[model samples]
Target: MPFKKYLLTGLMVWLPLAITIWVLLWLVGALDAVFGGLLSVINSVAPVAITVWSEKLRNIPGLGVVLVVSVMLVTGALVSNVAGRWWIRQWDRLFTNIPIVKSIYNSVKKVSDTLFSSNGNAFRTALLVQYPRAGSWTIAFQTGVPGGEVQNHLGADFVSVYVPTTPNPTSGFFLMLPRSDVIELQMSVDEALTYVISMGSVAPSLPAATLQKPKP
Candidate 1:
């Protein structure tokens, strides 16, 4: 039991950082491949002229890292303007017209923008909910309220919560539970996630008394 607790605690310590580093490495690899391929295409078109500079610029070891960060910053700046916004719309229109690629690309882009954009609201609050069965609960994020016909069908009090699975939070279920039933945890989303994945082995320093709040 002690060893199990320690192992869970250790995973809580390392998993976030490990996953973050893995994602960062994956992005870097993708960028490197894209830029390298572009350089190869240029080299094929113009054999003598762009050989050395293109090779160096495209894959300058650590420079690629700097370039990736710089490009992200530049892209952030561009999307902040009116003309840039129009250009973005046009680009999106082109993508939307594309056959199968549109669905995949647009869904991913929407999620990324929601999660990463400063103006967008997503994962705004972490909640505790009875999951799978009564008495047994899990941590979930309150994404938003039930909308449209679902709201009409389900009633106004239902809310949408994203309940992520352990070990791999990438896949999860979205449940529309009654808003009154959801227990709002005081802990942040990151802390709640650690608690969930560790399966209570790494208990958060929260007390039952502290969780008691006067009904609003």
Candidate 2:
């Protein structure tokens, strides 16, 4: 029993670190493969001297990640200007005009904009709400208020919330519950996610203000 306890404790210490490193290594490998593929395509048509250089570049590990980051920085700088904005608009128009591509592209674009835009409020607030049935509660995130015909039927008092499942937060139920039913929590979105993913094994500390009592 003692040996089993020690082994389990050791595993608990090492498992998270091992998985984190594995994920990083996989990401680096994927980026390197993309860069290598591009180089291969270039080598096919390039002069002998250039092809030799491309092959050498492909052999360097992590260079692909550096190149990708540099490209992102340059692209961000370009897209901040007027000409770049116009070009982006044209690019969006091109994609949005295509038949089948437009549907997929538009759907993804809308979701990305909602999730990542500074003005958007998706997943900003964590809440405790009764779910599945009465007397049962789960952690949920306030995505925003219900919109369109749904809002018309539900009225202004309801809000859209996402209740994520344990261990896998990507898949979840979307619910439009009355605003009065959800209790807002001071814990941050990241903290709430950690709690959900850990299946309630981890809990965020109470805020300092909550911990301190008002002067008597």
Candidate 3:
């Protein structure tokens, strides 16, 4: 019984570490596949000397992550220029003309821009809101105030919140709650997400100032 208990404890300690390493390796492989494609393109059009070097670059471990990051930085710098803006507009126009592709592309592009843009309003804060039934509460992200028809219907007092499911934050419900009813938490979004994903097992600690009693 002691040996069995020790074995179980060891498994518990190593299982999470093993799974994390596997997932990381899988991500690296996927990135390397993309880098491989870029190398193929270079092999076709680049000078023979450069093509030979690029082929060797593929064998370097973890190079894919560096290449991907470099590409993103270069792309960001490029897009900040006037000429790049013109080119991006032309590129967008080309994609926008494709009937079916345009619909999907436009929708995804809008969401990506809203979520990732520095100035975007999405997921601005985390809050506690009553969900499913009254008195029940859940962690939710404040995805800005409602807009368009939803805003018109709900009026200006409501804020749009996304309540992500436990252990999997990707899928969840979107609710527009009245600003008065929503309780704003002092926790950061990452802390709130950890609490949600852990199903309340990993509750965030409130600030000392918040916990302290008011002066009598």
Best by TM-score: 2
TM-score of 1: 0.75
Judged by lDDT against the true structure, how good is candidate 2?
A: 0.96
What value does the lDDT take at residue 151 in candidate 1?
A: 92
Please write out the lDDT profile of model 2 over residues 156-198, one tens digit for every residue.
9999999999899999999999999999999999999999999
Candidate 3 segments exceeding 4 Å error: 1-19, 37-57
Predictions in order: lDDT: 0.84, 0.96, 0.91
Model 1, span 1-216: residue lDDT tens? 999999999998898899899998888777777778877888888867678789778746546567778999999799889988999999999999999999998999977887887775578788989997889888899887888889999999988999999866778999999988899877877888878787767778766676675667
Give the TM-score (vs. native) of candidate 3: 0.82
Candidate 3 lDDT at 86 equals 96
Better of 2 and 3 by lDDT: 2
* Candidate 2 lDDT for residue 138: 95
Ranking by TM-score: 2, 3, 1
Q: What is the lDDT of residue 157 in candidate 3?
A: 97
Ranking by lDDT: 2, 3, 1
